[model samples]
Target: MNDYAQYEKDCEAIRTTNQQLLTEFSAWLKTAGLAAGTIKNHCSNIAFYVNEFLLYEEAIEAKDGFTEVDAFLGYWFIKKAMWSSQASIKSNAASLKKFYTFLYEKGLIDKQALADLKEDIKDGMPLWLATLARYEDPDEEDVW
Candidate 1:
């Protein structure tokens, strides 16, 4: 099989489970009384994080540890996404926090892993933005 064919196979393997978790995360947000727009944005953010980054790194579920989160926020998103900026970095970080909290409540990731992930965000955020600065136009609106 060609490379694209293998990639497609890998994607297909995770699709159902990925959709189920995202759908449940969406419902959980609704139940939390989040606004329609907020729920949409969070779910969209998580989907992109999972499907594009984590899954690309071979993560099949929300049970992964801090290394995955750090890599996504610190590197791949900026490298892969055209719209990346300080605001987007911050926004996706918030979304991932809430989404992972939900997964924690659902007993996907353990309490220790969640705590470490948050710590990873705190410690590594500066470096992530500095890396982003290399690619960002300082004069751009919302570049921060």
Candidate 2:
């Protein structure tokens, strides 16, 4: 197969794996006593992150997605997701933290990786929110 075909096959495999992980994550959320609606929201958020954003340009596995959170929240999500807003960004951040924590608990990621992901979310939230503000501002000179 050619490179593009190989990329497609790889992405399909990752997506298949992601579905099982999401199912387990959903159950974990339930065990934590989260409301059904909240669990649904979190699972949806993670599905978008792992399935769409992670697969958009490359077949990035969900376990490897901690490193992409910065770009996803700070730029790509704002530009790409039609539902992008302050509330949604905050919601997604929370979901990501929870998902990474789950991965860490399952030994899919190291402690340092989880720590770094949390730190990035904490440090980048203000800027990410500001970027959304600018992107949504009609009169902003440069929205890019």
Candidate 3:
């Protein structure tokens, strides 16, 4: 096939894949009994990850770069928030990780990507504590 033809075919394949992903996501949301507003929120979160992080990485950082599942956890949850309080950050990370796991299981991305990403985050809390303890006395509950 000609180069133009090959490019067209590739574009078509990607469109089809995206359509399927959207359909599956909607079904999953329904089966999970998610409310419409919550489903919208989840879709927005996914779009944010794709547009802000994944697309930026692909466009500027590396031509072949796709989504880094771990980055979703770190960036969306840990970095995108107004506050970095431990409890909120942990909760956000858990939610984002769950979304990534869903995408992985759906075959939208490689499972190892999510697994390795989560593995990298295994020491997140402890690492944060090591840094926090450097400046604050952990013995005092009201210090922070």
Candidate 4:
């Protein structure tokens, strides 16, 4: 296969394992009493992180993903996703935080790292929003 096709195949292989964790994450959300729509959104958002961003990688642990989370929220999601805004960014970060919590509770991630990730989200929101704004620029500044 060609490069893109090969990459697609690799991503699919990774998702096969990641999907099991997602199922567990969904169950946890239900037990926590989240609405069905909210659960679906969380699962979908995390699936994007796992299936897209974590592609062609060996390790699939939460500890290895914090930097990926930063890139996803700070850049890729803003440029590629239709829902690009402060609220959407916050929502995505929240989804990832919940997912990481699930991983932590499952003993898949370091507790301290998870706590740090939460703080990073709280601290990084403004910067993420500014980066998104820069990405959305329509060249208005050059019109003068």
Candidate 5:
């Protein structure tokens, strides 16, 4: 197969794996006693992160996505998601934290990686919210 063909194949496999992971994550959330609506929202946020943003440019597995949270929330999500707002940004960050913690407990990621992801979310949230404000500002001269 050609390179592009291989890329497509890889992406399909990743999507399938991500779907299963999401199912497992949802079940895990339920075991933790999260409300149904909260579980749904977390799964939805993670689904978009892994399936859409991760796969947008390459076949990035959810296991490898911890590193991309900064870029995703700091720019891509703010610009791409029509529902982007301060509240949504914070919500997504919380969802990601929960999802990654679940992944860590399942041994999909190491402790250090989980810690780093949490730290990145904590530190980057301010900038991500600021970016959202600028992106949504009608009067901001340089939104990008």
Candidate 6:
């Protein structure tokens, strides 16, 4: 009886659209057996993108709205500049490209927007975390 009740509850929870999709994606990722670190990285990147999208929506004062792809990238990535590190920003950009590509493939966005997002990343920006993580070469043992 308890097992059956639990199964019923799980089935009921799976009926919601967002829950169903999230469950399916999670199952797929689990079956794919990605490294734990990789899964964390991907999830973090996706969260960052979604957070920026929500911020963009709020900025426009739209009651119920999503930013066009251009406005999202331009304002979130180019204008506000919220990244703490170059590597982190690069990772987020790569994640956005993958995410928008998925959306475009699913017919959720126009192809032109994705195409316009393909500009080369500018190099030479020092990542703050990477700078902090640096340590003196172990062979050179002297330090004041």
Alpha-carbon runs more than 4 Å astray in model 1: 1-10, 57-59, 137-144
- The TM-score values for the models, in the order shown, are 0.84, 0.98, 0.49, 0.82, 0.97, 0.45
Q: Residues 1-144, candidate 2, lDDT per residue (tens digit)?
A: 998999999999998999999999999999999999999999999999999999999999999999999899999999999999999999999999999999999999999999999999999999999989999989997865
**Candidate 6, residue 90: how far the Cα is off, in Å:** 0.8
Backbone clashes in model 2, listed as residue pairs: none
lDDT of 4 at 28: 98
What's the C-alpha lDDT at position 90 in model 2? 96
lDDT of 4 by residue, 69-141 (tens): 7767887788778877888898899999999999889887887979888888888788888887777788645
Q: Rank the candidates by TM-score, best first.
A: 2, 5, 1, 4, 3, 6
Candidate 4: misplaced stretches above 4 Å?
Answer: 1-12, 56-63, 140-144
lDDT tens digits by residue: candidate 3, 28-68: 87678988876766655554444455444232111122335
Off by over 4 Å in 6: 1-36, 56-83, 120-144
For this target, which candidate reaches the highest TM-score against the unseen true structure?
2
Q: In model 6, how large is the Cα lDDT of residue 96?
A: 54
For model 5, what is the alpha-carbon lDDT of residue 17? 96
After the best TM-score superposition of candidate 1, give how far the Cα of residue 109 lies from its true spot, in angstroms: 1.0
* Model 5 per-residue lDDT at 123: 95
Against the true structure, candidate 1 has what lDDT? Answer: 0.81
Worst 10 residues of 1 by lDDT: 57-66
- Judged by TM-score relative to the true structure, which candidate is superior, 1 or 4? 1
lDDT scores of the candidates, listed in order? 0.81, 0.96, 0.52, 0.79, 0.93, 0.45
Candidate 1's TM-score: 0.84
Alpha-carbon RMSD, each predicted model: 4.0, 0.7, 8.3, 3.8, 0.9, 12.9
- Ten residues in sequence with the least summed lDDT for candidate 5: 135-144
lDDT of 1 by residue, 53-119 (tens): 7667464555563458778878888878999899989989889889888888998888988888888
